[model samples]
Target chain A: MEYFFELLLSGLTRGSIYALIALGYTMVYGIIQLINFAHGEVYMIGAFTALIVASILTMLGWNEIAILFIASVVAVVYSMAYGYTLEKVAYKPLRHAPRLSALISAIGMSLFLQNYVLLAQTSDFMPFPSLIPDLEILEPIAHLITTPEIAIILTTAIVMVLLTFMIKFTRVGKAMRATSQDREMAMLVGVDVNRVISITFIVGSATAALGGVLIASHVGQINFYIGFIAGIKAFVAAVLGGIGSMPGAVLGSLVLGCAEAFFTGFVSSDYEDVFAFIILVVILIFRPAGILGRSDISKV
Target chain B: MLELKNIKTFYGNIQALKDVSIEISEGEIITLIGANGAGKSTTLMSICGIVPPRSGEILFMGKPIQDMAPNNIVSLGICQVPEGRRIFPFLTVAENLDMGAFLRKDKDEIKRDIEYIYELFPILAERRNQAGGTLSGGEQQMLAISRALMAKPRLLLMDEPSLGLAPLIVKQIFEIIKKINTENKTTIFLVEQNANMALKVAHRGYVMETGRVSMSDTAANLLANDEVRKAYLGI
Candidate 1:
């Protein structure tokens, strides 16, 4: 029973990170119908930025709490800039071009970012500072779950709630939903679609950066290549839930995380990555649109 | 008031509008009647800057706005109730109306306008919480037109409001269009393939064929013309 609970908590931690990253994929895909392959690099860059900032702060003898908070803010801000620029430089010009052209551009951009990071920084795994605080409240169950895992789960819940509220009630959020549903009609009704698209990229990057920082702290190490694997996994989670659905993305991530956790615990840890992909393959074959995805039935 | 001077619009190499010129007076309900693919929707889209005219100037209140964006055009008091009633499928009915007033910042005014919309279409008020896609065709059309009205547009352009609707619902929508114009003192540019209904509601009309404006006259006169009567009205 205790082992089952431990695996469940671990799965929750993994699911939280996947949910955060999956949101970026789902949102960008919802509005533009593009996969945004470079999104993974954004996450990796986020972790690197946080790592550098945290190191500098620590070297300067700053307090641990301040360092964590400041580093996260900087990472999010930097990633947002990268996401905005990525859209403008690569995707914006290709907005009117064929979809495949944009997809290729995204792939090229991912490669460019990876190589740029490798040349600038070491292509090595860096020890991530334990940024998430150790909470005394959960000391009794330390064996079952750590403070970082608790933080991950609680943070994801809060972010999800906040995001749902924004989409349900806020002006910009409604504009986003409106634009995604029918962009031309959104324009007809006075939505600045370009502005909306930019905002989506910014928001997606912000969440992915948060995910990057959290996952890095939890796992205790990160590298430039971390984003590649994490991003593909999150993409699978998003697709498993239904690519364009918000709750679907979160639900998909949880299901995927839990599935992998159980497979690793009872089956074999070596084939865990393989397990995630197998589920993806099975989902694609059985429910190609996704679990919560609506099949394409365009109204005429 | 709106004026289109030699508007030529294209979708890549395919020309959708060809040298179409039109003039809409400030307080008149004008209709553009045409067959399918005659570029009626393209004209409205061009005016809204969705598909900007390739070589023409659209003067909204005498300011050349051919190069503006679609949102800017709406901000300039032009709103389009496009073909197929393009409401946000997942948004609630009230939310759709809110999008119509996307540019307005006055909270109280927006609320009042929403109430006014509910008054205009009481059924929409009943379905305020329902997702737009779940509505029946007639209901969606009502929501679509009501959504445009939420913008309080000076010049309202509608494309095929009567399409794929029952005759009773079509009559109701036309009545609302007429009501909106006279009561709100709004200038309207209506595009429709339902020539008879359009002619009845319009003060003046233009006939478009194969992306060109072939004729223009008073709506009553066009309704009585032999060519229009045979080609369009099926009389």
Candidate 2:
């Protein structure tokens, strides 16, 4: 029972990170119907940006909490800038082009960003400073839950709740939903679809950056290639949840995370990636629209 | 308040509108009526900048608007209730209406306008909280029109508001269109395949065929024309 509980806690923490990254995938897909392959690179950039910030703050002798806050804020801002630039340079020009062409452009962007970062920073793994203070109050459940795990879960919950509120209550959020449904119709009714698309990239990138920062802190290390694997896993989660559905992304991530944790905990950890792919294939075969995705019928 | 001269539009190599010219004064209900593939929708789309004219000019309040973006044109006070009642399916009726007023910043005015919309279409008021996709065809059309009106547009462009509805619903929609034109004093540019309803309500009409306006006259004269009767009125 204790072992099961431990696995569940770890799964939730991992799932929270996946959910944050998956949201970027799901939202961009919802609005533009383009799978932004470079989104993973944005996450990678975020981790490195945080690392750089942490090093600077540590040199300045800042407290751990202040260092974490400043590092996260700077990382999120840098990632947002990268996301915006990526969209403008790589994706915007190809907006009206064929889907395959846009996809090729995205993959090209992914490679460009990876190489750029690799040349700028070292290709080797860098140690991520542990900034989350260990909470001694949870000593009773310390075996099952750690401070970092609690922080990851709480941050995800807060972000999700805030995101939901924004989507449901805000004007820009309404415009985004309207644009996703029908771009031309949204334009006819006065939505600047371009602006909405830009905002989507901004919000999505910020969340993904948050995930990158948190995951780096929890794992205590990151590399230039970390985003590629994490990005693919989150893409799997997004598709599992139903590509365009926000709640579906989170649900899918949790399910995938739990499956991964259990597979590694009970079975051979080496087969984790294999199990994740198998689950994706099986789910797609049965429910192509995903767990919560509605199969849309194109109206004549 | 709106003028188009020798406007031409194309979809790739296929020309959808050729030499289409129109002129409308403020507060007049001018309708473009035609059969399927006659470019009536294209004419409206051109004005909205969804499909910009490759040639000629469009002026709104005498300011050249052909080069503007769709949202910019909308912000200039022209709003479209598009064909097929393209209300956001996932949004509640109220949210759909709120989206229509997206560019407007005055909250109290928006609230009052929403109240006015409820008065205009009582059925929409009742289903305000329901998702727009679930509404009946007639109700959806009403919501589309209401959504456009929420923008407080000076010029309202309506495309096939009566499409896919029962005769009774069509009649109800036409009545509302007329009421909006007269009571609100809003200039309307309507496009419809249903010439019978469109001609009856509009002050003037243009007949389109094969991407060009074949005829233009006062509504009563167009309705009386033998060629229009044979081709469009099904007489």
Candidate 3:
């Protein structure tokens, strides 16, 4: 029972990170109907920026809180700028093109970014500074929520709440929902559709960068290839949660994280991906639209 | 006032509107009538810059706006209630209406317009919190028009507002259109297939066939013309 509780605690901690990253995928997909393949690179860029900024701040004798704040700000801004540039240069021109072309472009962009990062910052894994103090909340029964875990979960929950509020109560959020539903109608009603699309990318990438920083802080090391697996996992979480549903992504990430924990703990670490695939297949076979996904019937 | 002179619109290889020239004076309701695919909706779309004319001039209040973007056009006091009642399905009726006035900065005015929209379409007011997709066809149509009105546009362009509504509901919508015109003095350009009903409410009308403006006349005169009545009204 203690072991199970420990697994659940760790599962939730990792799930928080997945949820934050999945939000980036779900958000961009919701508004643009395009899978931003380069989103993972945004994560990688965030981790590297945080690493550089934290090291600089530490060298300058800054305290933990100040370094964390500066690192987060720089990482978020850099990621948002990268996301904006990616959309303007690659996705914007292919806005009306076939889905296959966009998907290919996204893959190409992912590869290019991976190589660019590899060339710029050596292929070695770099140790990241821990921002949160490792405070244990439970007695040594082999499992208790640590400070990083608590921080990840709380921060993700808060961000999700703020995002929900924005989407529900703000005018820009309404415009985003409008543009997603019917682009032409939104434009006719005086929505700057392009600007909304840009904002979606910016929001998605910024959150992804934050996720990168948090995950790096938790694990203590990151590399150029760090985003690849995390990105794929987050994409899976987004799909499992129903791609466009915000709450769905969170739930999906939790379920996925739990599944991975169980697989790693009981079966084997190498079999984690196999378990993920099997779960995805089984879930889709039983519920094709996903746990919370609604079937969309196209009307003329 | 809105004017389109020598406007030509094309969809790939097919031309949808050819040299379609017309004028809609402020404080008047103008209608364009045609058969299926006769460039009626295309005309309205061109005026709002949805489908820009290949070679022509479009003037809004004597200012050329042929190359303006859709949002910019709306900012210039032009808004559209497009065909098929394209209300955001996931949004509530209230949110859908809010999107219509997205460019406005005055909070009080937005609230007042929303209340007025509720008064105009009481059923929508009752369903303000319901998802737009759940509304009946006629109700959705009403919401669509009210959403456009939230923009407080100087010129409102409506396409096929009565396309799928019941006859009684169609009558109700036309009555509301007339009321809006007289009460707000909003210049309206209506594209419709219901020639008989459109002519009954419009001051002037244009007849389009096969991507060309086949005829143009005063609404009463067009209603009496043999060609329009036989081809469109089935009278």
Model 1, TM vs. native: 0.99
Per-candidate DockQ values are 0.92, 0.81, 0.85
Question: Model 1 chain A — which ten-residue stretch has the worst lDDT?
Answer: A291-300
Relative to the real complex, the DockQ score for model 1 comes to 0.92
Ranking by lDDT: 1, 2, 3
Put down candidate 1 lDDT per residue, B1-235, tens digits, no spaces.
Answer: 8999999999999999999999999989999999999999999989999999999889988899999988888999999999999979999999999999999989899999899888888999999999999999999999999999989899999999999999999999999999999999999999999999999999999999999999999999999999999999999
Query: Which candidate achieves the best DockQ against the true structure?
Result: 1
Report the lDDT tens digits of candidate 3 across residue range B130-153.
999989899999999998998998
Q: Candidate 1 residues A129-193, lDDT tens each?
A: 99988889889999999999999999899999999998889999999999889988999999999
Collision count of model 1:
0
Error of 3 at A256 (Å): 0.6
Whole-model alpha-carbon lDDT for candidate 3? 0.88
- In the range A65-162, model 2's lDDT, one tens digit per residue, is 99999999999999999999889998899998899998999999999889998899879999999989898897888888999899999999999999
Error of 2 at B227 (Å): 0.9
Q: By DockQ thresholds, what CAPRI class is model 3?
A: high
